[model samples]
Target: MARIAIIFLTFVCVFGGATFVKSIEEDFIRLPLTSLHSRSRRKADVVDPNAKKVNLWNDRNLQYGINITVGTPPQPFILHLDTGSADVWVPSVNGDCPYLCKAVNKYDSSKSSTYKEIPGKTFTLGYETGGLSGSVAEETISFAGLEIKNQVIGIGENQDTDLNSYPLDGIIGFPWSGATSQTDPKSTILGNLHKNGHIKKRFACLKLHQVNEQPGGELLLGGCDVEAEHWGRVYGNGYWEIPIDKVEAFGTDGNSLDSICGPGSSVPDCRATFDTGAAVIGGPSYLIDPIASKLGASKYDENINDYIVDCDDQTLGNLEFTFGKFKVVMTPGDYLSKDGNTCTLGFARLDDLSALLLGDPFLRKVTLLMNQEKDEAGLAKSNIDKPVARPT
Candidate 1:
């Protein structure tokens, strides 16, 4: 998915220092999410309007999704909560697609009393992985006890084969209004929520659980978790991009590898985008090649475009990413994924984009908070040691 920022306009308040102003009696929604690959031993909680919660699901640590209903009577579907793009879309039963669309649920407008077709209006979205094109329509969409009436959404007419690998019915984009296909900002789901006074603050917080955890994590809409530690300010144009002060690697003996970037290195001024939709990190080959070599991953597969490494290597060390004064360290367990005996480096080569794409591998360690109103983002170490048993 193309990295983009969520845009909005609202008053800013100091989180850790000052008192927070509650815009509404029911100010925030703490939605619980599930992972498709894991089963939970927890039970569901009652839905409290004051603390509205919804069920979300994760697909093999690659994607996280939520359950939502559309139309009057409410037809349910599992939609991916994508932060990299904007626009809500579902597979349409009326669409020409048959093979992949049949694998999951499809939106049937004819059965929906509140469905309103927007003639001649088409929705098209593209991402680094795949793309989709469809027709535009409006319907009453509900999720996590919150109802959005007449919310514009896409009914997929065509889809890429690559998307079929995931266990999802559709996508719920969380980027800015400018990224949506709709010309009117109010037509987008988040935009409509803001205009309708459903969400007081124009911000969202994501806490992704560890891969081994039973249930997934929580996604907070309209506010940040006060308990989580806050990091540096976000800086970029239209994406959730941040500046990197340095990237350092170490061996099992704690000896530093050759400097990748920052002071006294060939390259300086590194930047990265936080993307929830991406499963792995991606950067220029020039930057990744050195890190891969230092880790003893010298064999690069031309067809797969990734370096193959030994999964049983117990001598690997940590990878540190310094942003401003804050540092995030990833152990070998966090950066390398093992499938049987073969293991591949989580970081990939993306020569097309200048900045690195920091995906789930990096995000899993932090609770990312994005403020659309301020065009800023923040991060905090995830409190995964004490997982919250949310409604799922």
Candidate 2:
């Protein structure tokens, strides 16, 4: 869903202490997200002894997720619900992997009566952070209170260092493109629920909190509570889609900032996909360069191919954008990752990608309601409200 950058070693201090954070007026299920960094190597050119003859992944300072249940009796483990890529997988307990994967949760087929092996099928997933290698198998996976039967999943036999020290046991793919191989052609787990008449609608809402110990927000599988006061006006429902009407940057003094694209000019108004899985905002260099300069962000560092910034600078104004009629502004806290004195810009340049990507940094300020059936997405300013019950 998003790209990763090589993280430089820096001391981390909790800028904001713990709090019971709320998400856009409590219209969705509340899930917790934590900031994580990997103390692993970044190169994939050399083969890793722990990874079996396969390409590895690398990176740092990303999001870590919560526990999910799999198997008949329900074995719970932490898994990343990534909308960017599809394929539900976990590390293999039987794998002879490196010490890096020693802390990961593995699946044991023999422990679950519902588990079945799909012989001769291997599953491998590559990401900026690392790679995962395993086999295809069938098992039951449940979310909230809904359950899907005989779901295809990948079991990891090998994992590279990028995946090491992660607080995740596996990953669950939740997008339209949800298959790992041609042998299987089916909608994602949530999609299947809607198709099989399990859910009333093919929709989900995600509201992620800022850094906190106890956060509020959840993946609403059936859809958001339109009855709820905070449910923003639905714009596009297909995939949280929005048009980038224009881009603007503000200096520390709230004045108009300059960029290579010129001042306040529309940058083609490219399409942007709102993704919870991506940690950084990505677009063409032409669009991002001016923003970096205005923020006083540092030039590109070849070591990471990204702009690192001064984390402690708070005088900057919000990086604003026009989405349809909505005005979305990203404050310094939203666009800057400040850990001690080591600060970095949340922007990543992907000149090759035509669509501008609004990752967690943007999603953090808005509520994303996605309706898979209609292929549309809705955005609205988050409102704080009384706590709501989570879907079981």
What are the candidates' C-alpha RMSDs? 11.3, 12.6
Residue by residue across 1-392, what tens digits does model 1's lDDT show? 43221110001111333221111112444444332211122221211233433334655566667778888888877777766656678888865654345535678898999999888988666654455688888899887667898888888878663443234666787664444344234445555666767676566677776655645656666654432233344553445676777987776666867677888888887887787766777778988888777766778775445677777666766678877655787777677765556687767777876777788778888777776666666666677734222112
So what's the TM-score on candidate 2? 0.74
RMSD of 2: 12.6
| Residue pairs with backbone overlap in model 1 | 34-56, 34-58
lDDT tens per residue, model 2, 8-124: 211222223322111121222322222221112222111112211100111132543544567978776656655554567776778655632463466777789899899898866
**Residue 381, candidate 1: alpha-carbon lDDT:** 64
Alpha-carbon runs more than 4 Å astray in model 1:
3-55, 180-189, 227-236, 385-392
Candidate whose TM-score is highest: 1
